[model samples]
Target chain A: MEGRERKTLVLGVIGADVHAVGNRILDYAFTQAGFKVVNIGVMASQEEFIQAAIETSAAAILVSSLYGHGEMDCRGMREKCQEAGIGDILLYVGGNLVVGKQDFGPVEKLFRKMGFDRVYPPGTMPEEPIADLRRDLGLA
Target chain B: MELSVKQMDPEEFGRQRQEVLTAWPTGKEVDFDEAVAYQKELPAAKVMAAKLAQGKAKGVTYAQPRAGVALISEHIELLRYLQDEGGADLLPTTIDSYTRQNRYKEAQGGIEESRSIGRSMLNGFPAVNHGVMACRRVVESVGVPVQVRHGTPDARLLAEVTLAGGFTDFEGGSISYNIPYAKDVPVENTIKYWQYVDRLVGLYEENGVRINREPFGPLTGTLVPPSISHAVGVIEAVLAVAQGVKSLSLGYGQCGNLIQDVAALHTLPLLAQEYLKKLGYPEVMITTVFHQWMGGFPQDEAKAYGVISWGAVAAALGKATKVIVKTPHEALGIPTKEANAAGLRTTKQVLNMLRDQTLPQTEELTLEEKMILRETRLILDKVLELGEGDMAVGSVRAFQAGVIDVPFAPSRFNVGKILPARDTTGAVRILDFGCLPFDREIRDFHQERIARRGRDEGRDPSFQMVIDDIYAIGKGMLVGRPRG
Candidate 1:
């Protein structure tokens, strides 16, 4: 194990969303891969993630929403993070993020335009995000 | 205080019913005596418990569809179409999302909006807002026995109002509804809430009305191992039976593997009975309801039919008492009534073609069945142990301890430790067991199966398989193979 403290990650299901299974898996995967995960749980506001990130010096904030109301709930999250002084925090959002069966390309593009570092389609596993966190946080 | 697995006193339940009834004016319309008498006069065909018994006796699987609308008239029209056209043997009045959240005001607004717009607005019927008489109208209009299907953590009022409104069957349980559908609701609160629900049903049973209680079986439905769902369903059954509810239709979601799905359907009622007997409620009537694939569906209607047929075959062969049908428009969101009817017809057609045919028992089927029984017992045993031999207390503590976790459940109360993925054969196997109380041999079996899949795929068995399997059905595949 590395002597230095594990890089911190703040994660939660943003908005009135409570989809927990994948959020927990991400927590397990990241922690198993040696990261300090700050799980804010569900119904989390953007400020909560940013606040946790600031408190823990988190390198990334993983946001999940499964209730299909994510777009409305996730609005101006980047702006909120910016105002919270954690603008550069690696932000990832995923899970049935929209209300209907739209193309994932457009959905991902939409979230990207909103300033998310990465956007994943629903049914995404932890491997991709874990790898992304490793590479993005310069652990590799 | 922790709710022990015990029956609620009748007067206490009556008092609780008063508060629940007064939550809405419609609730006030529920006269338990009249409701019980109304249910007593209903024909055998109009009662879900009786229909479930009939299906069990005939050794056939009935088809049920999830459907609801904002307006009461439209809701009845939809049920009539499904009954006359779809040939569904069972019916469900799906409660609206607003009702599931106990937001009756918003549900009332949606109903008003639907009335004005000349179209259904809300996702489902807000039975709570519509109250008892309206629910009775829906029930009276339907030929088949109707069940109230909803994802509600606290269904106390909904249960009282619907049961008193003349519905003969109810769906949901503390764990089944809460862990998968909610995020922050405490499991302890839900368990206590549903205790009132089960006790209410028991109250009806005491009044000579038989209401079939089915615990929603497809938790997080995204690759849940049969054992996890089985354990929860069995726990809920034990709790319901303890409260004196007699008839139950414990359900399981089709996991796509015929052997495994059939195995799940076979083992669920058995597991429920096994636990109920062990827990001192030995004589409860138990039936199995197999849910059609609860995962992602193909956008193409024909491909979706292929899935529906596969599920039908599983249900028919598995000999599930009824199969919850999914529509061709699943990927596109809430389906039209026509699409809903079509899905039911598709399942009925497949079921008819396979009448009296059963999946011949094989060594593999037997082995899968045995593994499920064993794995489920391990979890349930740990739950009892954690609760000091009480299921109600154990259920809350089990979730707290990560001993009975539902995979992908959004409940903060659920410790999300288990990660499930399809093994080489497409049956779900645990990649990360989390805090599941499986013994070493059970753990080895899962590991070996996953390891074999990894070796066959020329890749390490990782969470990548979970992602692949999730999108596989949508892409016309069952196993998510890596792209060449």
Candidate 2:
């Protein structure tokens, strides 16, 4: 356990958001926290995520959307992943996922319905997702 | 990539307009004849060029705030608040991201979602998706002129819809919009796209409509030097005028140094006029806008107010026609309407107090102006030389050769070789000149400035200093000094 292989996670800003800063920060944080992070960078479509997940055999797919169109962008992503033969892979999303300030409860529930295992609001620190990933993946 | 700087032929433009109008449902609502009629009836006060000219003639600096919400009603209400309660002299309709990327369908969805939720789901007004009628309502709701401020590389359709909808001013240039806002968009494509936009403005002018065109002055808004942004602004202005755009507004983002900021503003209009006249477009009306510090802002509302006030003072003393106001919640995410109004109020108060006080013609100010002029001339001259007297061709080649480079841009087309850092006085100076066509004297000046700052800080001039300066303001400091 002391020298166990790190869990691989695919991370990116989904849809057309080219928010490089947050993506870079997350890449650094996950690497520092001993996870294998394959940051696909920004403006990634759902197909790109599936391809990367298959290529890296990633344990989780962390999709980030900052430009408030996450609901539309994330819709059907789970079904797409299942069709791509990676249905069991973990899915997480965070950021200013929606435009306007809707209650986080409903937002989280909506993402869960879309098959995301975890949802984070804007300004969510990297550690929160990392800790949750450890428990969910039994890496703890 | 074979871009033309010539005025678009009427027949060609008309054919293109047909395709452009059919891009989205809202586009279909823009009837050129009706739009022209609507624009003719708009009062002089709602005409941006008229307001800017009035401000310039009277030596007054007008205040404008960036604000837009999803719903048309809410957006109009927000702008009204900025105009009435905040005392904003001009208003803006910031288009949402989806619309900026020409994804009108998603923007339409955002508008409907915002309406159902009773909150703005989109970050900005989807003016294109809302079409000519909704935009006209927005323009009519506010007493002041409303400018279309969005970062769209291919804004041809947007320009057509917005100008037809009664927006008197349009912001963004090919270089500014592409280098700063896009990752893989080619410079030539955006330039060609913007030519269509400018040609549309020209057509409106021919039909007796006077629309103001502005090239976003702050390229990356990091530590952009005066010369780089100036060259881009002048180039865009020349391009616009070539397409028959009559009224042009060139802008400069505030650097913290008082003398440098003042000098940048002072020389922008003068240089633009000289270049425009030299380029055989002497009749073009030019105006200058000073954007209140476009970089990182302090999270503390009070400190942010201080920064905003200093920007206002610069704009006033520099005699810029207008200043884009920044809110106190800049360090946070998108600001609330109240915060936006607060910022405009702060800027208006400062502008009023310093209206009569002129920036003194001190030796430092003169030297700064001279230095900026010299650097700007060198870059622009090389660009012209590269184009072989054709700016459209030269701009693409200039960027390809890295003769004109924007620091910290993510665009694959951008060279991203230049590195900028603050001088001893917190004036942004080039640390690495990249491949900019500057002579040895200009290089020596920037080297000496950085060396002096490094000597005082007991460290060498390096990328670390540039990194520190990037995060300095957010950390409550102008120059990011190393912690003791």
Task: Assign candidate 2 its CAPRI class.
Answer: acceptable
DockQ of each: 0.23, 0.29
lDDT of 2 at B200: 83
At residue B165, give the lDDT of candidate 2: 91
Question: Where is model 1 more than 4 Å wrong at Cα?
Answer: A1-140
Model 2 chain B lowest lDDT segment of ten: B1-10
Quote the lDDT for A23 in model 1: 67
Fnat values, one per model, are 0.30, 0.20
In candidate 1, what are the lDDT values of residues B389-447, reduced to their tens digit?
A: 99988888898888987777767687887888888889999999998888999999999
lDDT of 1: 0.85
Per-model RMSD to reference: 4.7, 3.4
User: For residues A1-140, could you state the per-residue lDDT of candidate 2 as single tens digits?
Assistant: 25998889999888767655567567877887899999887778899899999999999999998767788789999999999999999999997787654567998999999999999976566789989999999988
Residue B484 in model 1: shift from native, Å? 1.5
